[model samples]
Target: MNIFSRRARLGNAWAVNVRLRIAQGKIATIASAAEPQAGDVVVDTLLPALANLHSHSFQRAMAGMTEYRAQDRESFWTWRTLMYRFLDHLSPDHIAAIAALTFMEMQKAGYAAVGEFHYVHHQPGGQAYDNPAELSLQIIQAAALTGIGLTHLPVLYTYGGLQAQPLAGGQLRFGNSVDAFCDIVSLSEKAMAALPADTCIGIAPHSLRATSESDLRQALDLHAGMPVHMHIAEQTKEVEEVAAMRGARPVEWVLGQCEVNEQWCLIHATHMTESETAALAKSGAVAGLCPITEANLGDGIFNGASYVAHGGTFGIGSDS
Candidate 1:
């Protein structure tokens, strides 16, 4: 058992001489405005822990590697090309080590949990491993070792771009059929069963560009009742391409085609019109914003003022 006395925030007010009783690694009870015992540990301040709702932990190694002038006109697409090259050589051991170090740093920074949007599933040559969940289990092991809560989102990345284009270049490793994707999710769920009680397994359709409407529906059905996440409308080019192909913006298409609600998180809804923004806000989905990554990639600013005014929910992420 653990006991501590500190000045703690209770909802909108602060309470002094608050005592917390921790048992079985959880807070068993809390007492407000109470005197401390002789053996109590006193602290001057306390704060609630934060959750990083989006992360690609393996990308931490490539943080400063792409800061130089690679092209005459550097952009998100250019940076992505560099990232693809970087991941082309990362072994499972490398992924695990990087993820463990990243999760440890997050814990030190007061993060209680993380949502990992994992996509790399195959080997360097785009061959499936003997076990489909091999790479996913590596990430799960990293989370278990670091004592951080996990929400593992196994991504379904079938195509390279709009119109169901074939996977090319570094995108080869993330490709899988819808049936194969379901098997991976099932195996990943079993692999995560030994983890802490709070660990979650979810579905991620990389984006509208990477998945078709049918594939998206199948993935959602495969992991029904779980939190669903996707990258949406992060770039102007993406918005334009989606509009050109589907005759609708990305957000508009998703909101109309799917039943997005509280269990959904649309990451980087950065490029949206006023109507799209208001419509998504009414859908009760969380906006997964990553300001640091957005600024680094030169993605446009999210309409936070309008979104929050419409009673939209939001959560921050380290989308690296």
Candidate 2:
């Protein structure tokens, strides 16, 4: 396939009357100072599509429902309580429908791919479905339907809090032993075989507060070199809880414990200190920022200026 654009942004500059050749679902070649051909798809403006690096597709169904204030002092925790209640009623069919719509909207908005940070795994009562990857297959099917490149992240959520508390309420659906999570990843890999080659699987260790050091290590070891994503310092309460239990802030502790690099993406690293920001900038890991969701949840602003000044890499996500 060939595409001729009157104005197209190629790298850092714009070219007039450029032609791009698509071969095997990828751009094979680009030619500038070209004329319109007889059989070419023409467009006025063309730019590279983006990848939404973090998202929870199931939450897209509860979009406008959570905007109402249920309390005088509304916060992320309070909004989370309502989200838990809302998710209890979603079946696998509902998950597929919601995910399909979310992926379609992402494509319409110029996103060619998404990294779904999926966590809702089991039935509402904490019981496993006949297949461990039931919900995961739904996400895979949705991505297939929308033709979106998917990096499905099966999150390992073991506990409820930083101190290894038992799972409760909606957290029950997300809870899984390290062994069970491995099974889910294995089954999900099998299900993704029907999708395009670019559709792949990754692992997420929900967050510092939700997993122990031992559990996190086990989850990391499950996927040898795949993309690793984790929720870091998103909320102040979470930061305090992790610091109290682990004796260091979330970013500082993870940096000390892990060999973070380009393959890792730390989501919502919104509450970092000067040293933590500098260290993360130098670590070669992508800072996954979800500005819209961060603002909605009242999560603090990321240190973008300072991080960029230090030559950091970052990506944007919807995260809903």
Candidate 3:
């Protein structure tokens, strides 16, 4: 028996005689019936770890080195070109090695789980790999190796924008049709099922620009009932184009068209109208924010104060 009584929680007060019974790597029982013995270890406090709701684990390596300049008006678009150059060189093994290093740091920082928004699927030339989901599996392997929870959200990138343009050279690996994306998602799900119950697969449509209405509907139907994620309103040019093409803003368009519920995470809803902001806050979906990356990319300040006041739920990410 162990006496573990305290009016406070999680570093608020000390714990005494908090003997733990472990069953299959889980706590089976906590006995607080008696005092601590002489050799008993004393713990100050304990709490369940938090989750990083979004990440591109491989890009963690590129965090601080992207601020160089070549000419005037160096914007996010110019920075993206540099990112393409960075991504062009990574193979599955290289990505796995990088991810393992990053995840170890995340564990030490107290993030027990990471939701990876993955998109690099094929080779640089957009050719199918021997293992279509090879890169994704590598990330999963890294997460397992580092002892952090993984929610693998594979991204679906189709066209470049509302113009239905072809993907540029840097975007080849992220390109996927509705059929190909479904196949990869299925394969990822089967692989994720082999992990602990806490590890699972989620779906991601890269953004409104990347997928047509038909493609979006197809993916939604295919991955129905799964946690879904998407990038939205991260840049003003994107907002302008989306508004011009669809006559509705990105977040507004998505909320009007699809089911925006708790199972969805709208990444980077940085630009919003008052109505859109209020609606999103009430929508029960997680608003994925990357404040550090946002500042680096000049993505503008998100309405954090208003969103919180409206009862919005959000989680941090390292979007790279």
Q: In candidate 3, which residue ranges exceed 4 Å CA deviation?
A: 1-26, 30-40, 68-71
lDDT of 3 by residue, 1-320 (tens): 22233211334554444565556766576664445555544555545578888888888777766766568777888887777888898888899999999889888999989999998898878888898888888988898888889999999999977888999888888999999898899888888777877798889999999888899999998889999999999999999999999889999999999999999999998999888889999999999998877887789988988888999999998676
lDDT of 1 by residue, 199-292 (tens): 9988889999999988899888867898899999999998999999989999999999888999999999999899989998999999999999
Worst 10 residues of 1 by lDDT: 1-10
User: How high a TM-score does candidate 2 get?
Assistant: 0.93
Q: How close is candidate 1 to the true structure, as a TM-score?
A: 0.94
Each prediction's TM-score versus the true structure? 0.94, 0.93, 0.90
Candidate 2: 10-residue stretch with minimal lDDT: 64-73
Task: Rate residue 293 of model 1 by lDDT.
Answer: 82
Write one digit per residue (lDDT tens) for candidate 2, span 1-320. Answer: 99999999989999999999999977899999999898999999998899999999999998988776777889898888989999999999999999999999999999999999999999998999999889999999999999999999999999988779999999999999999999999999899988877788999999998888998898887688989999999999989988888899999999999989999999999999999999999999999999998998889999999999998999999998
lDDT of 1: 0.90
User: For candidate 3, which ten residues in a row score worst on lDDT?
Assistant: 1-10
Which residue runs does candidate 2 get wrong by more than 4 Å?
A: 6-17, 22-29, 39-45
lDDT, candidates in the order shown: 0.90, 0.93, 0.85
Q: Is candidate 1 or candidate 3 better by lDDT?
A: 1
RMSD vs true structure, all candidates: 1.9, 2.1, 3.2
